[model samples]
Target: MPFFVYGTLRPGEHNHDRFVRGRDVRAQPAFLHGGALYDGPGHPFATDGDGTVRGALLTAAPAEYPGLLVALDRLETYLGPGDPRNLYERVVRPVEVPGSGTVRAWVYLAAPAVTRTLRANGPRIPGGDWLSHRPPRTDRLLPPPGPRTP
Candidate 1:
């Protein structure tokens, strides 16, 4: 199955060049329904919800599929099904590809523990589009403009 990438794994993101570049047969815009995106430490996490998450469906080259699967599992910290240490759980979900119909693809979603935490405190990414989502600023606030120095 193709992988549905919704966060850093999407094209032009930091992880894309390192993990997905040259390994995919095609990467196209896709959407996953009944899901929501939440801001993670540096990336974004998808969880089961009522909203739609925007991402890409990446069909890996036949020769690269096996390795790509292993790599993605490791990157997402998915040790196995129901593993306590897993941050994300890999599951097959239906993704809608533009021009094409819906296809079942591998999707990484926040694990139960992570989802609980996210529900309690994590900020949801508006519009569920990680590529266009900008995290809120964390920089210290500055005082109102004082008299300009010469």
Candidate 2:
């Protein structure tokens, strides 16, 4: 089984540098057929519909699966693949990458509803799992606090 990774698991992204160290990442243009990626509570997941996501296509040794699972154990919350309750689950699915023909990759997904609801509420604040990895858009980088006045 090919384990596809999207979201923070991506190279140079937060999770990659932190846990995985992003050693063996292969670049690919992957697309999740029917779901959009969202920054959820602490990770990403798929919704009930169709959409696309992109990231790395890391090839793991057959024996590596067990170690990989253990590595992801804490990060993915052990929800048992494809379950809303789990942080991330393994799914054997197809994605469309521009250069690569219809390819199979493993991706981490979270509940879209959860993300949609969060989105509707307001922008996700930078804190906890969210405060790392992603680079800030110039507009988003807040100016330093103003000097105190008497």
Candidate 3:
């Protein structure tokens, strides 16, 4: 099954380069209905809800699917269903793929505890799109101000 990724794993994001690039057979714009996105420490967390979340649907290359799945599971801290240490839970969710209608895809949603906390106090991403809602980078490396002419 394709994976619906809304956060770091989306195209051009850091994790996309590290974990998804070259491994996906195809990546296309998709949306998850009945969901919400919230700002996490350095990424974003999705929770099941009434909002719509914009994302990408990634179909893994057949040769890469097995490894990719394991890598993603590790990356998301998912350790099977109902694991106490999981940050996300891998589950099948209906993702609306452009021109293809809705299809069931793997989505990593915030674990139960994380969802509860996020609902209680986390900052919800207003637009439910992490790419557009992420905070500005404060750590960008500049070229030392062009040698600082005296």
Name the top TM-score candidate: 3
The Cα error of candidate 1 at residue 64, in Å, is: 0.5
| Tens digit of per-residue lDDT, candidate 3, span 1-150 | 999999989988889888988765589999999999999999999999989999999998888999999999999999999999999999999999989999999999999999999999999998799988886644444455555668
Which candidate number would show the highest lDDT if scored against the true structure? 3
Clashes of each: 0, 12, 0
- What TM value does model 2 have? 0.60
- Candidate 2 per-residue lDDT, tens place, 1-150, comes to 455566666655666666665334345545566655555544555442444455556665666566665776567675674466764455667766667677776555543445457556634323212324345534336776799779
Candidates ranked, most accurate by TM-score first? 3, 1, 2
Residue 81: error of model 2 in Å?
Answer: 5.2
Evaluated at residue 44, the lDDT of candidate 2 is: 54
> Cα RMSD (Å) per model?
7.0, 7.8, 3.1
Residue range 8-114, candidate 1, lDDT tens digits: 88887768878988775589999999999999999999999999999999998889999999999999999999899999999999999989999999999999999
Q: What C-alpha lDDT does candidate 3 achieve relative to the native structure?
A: 0.92
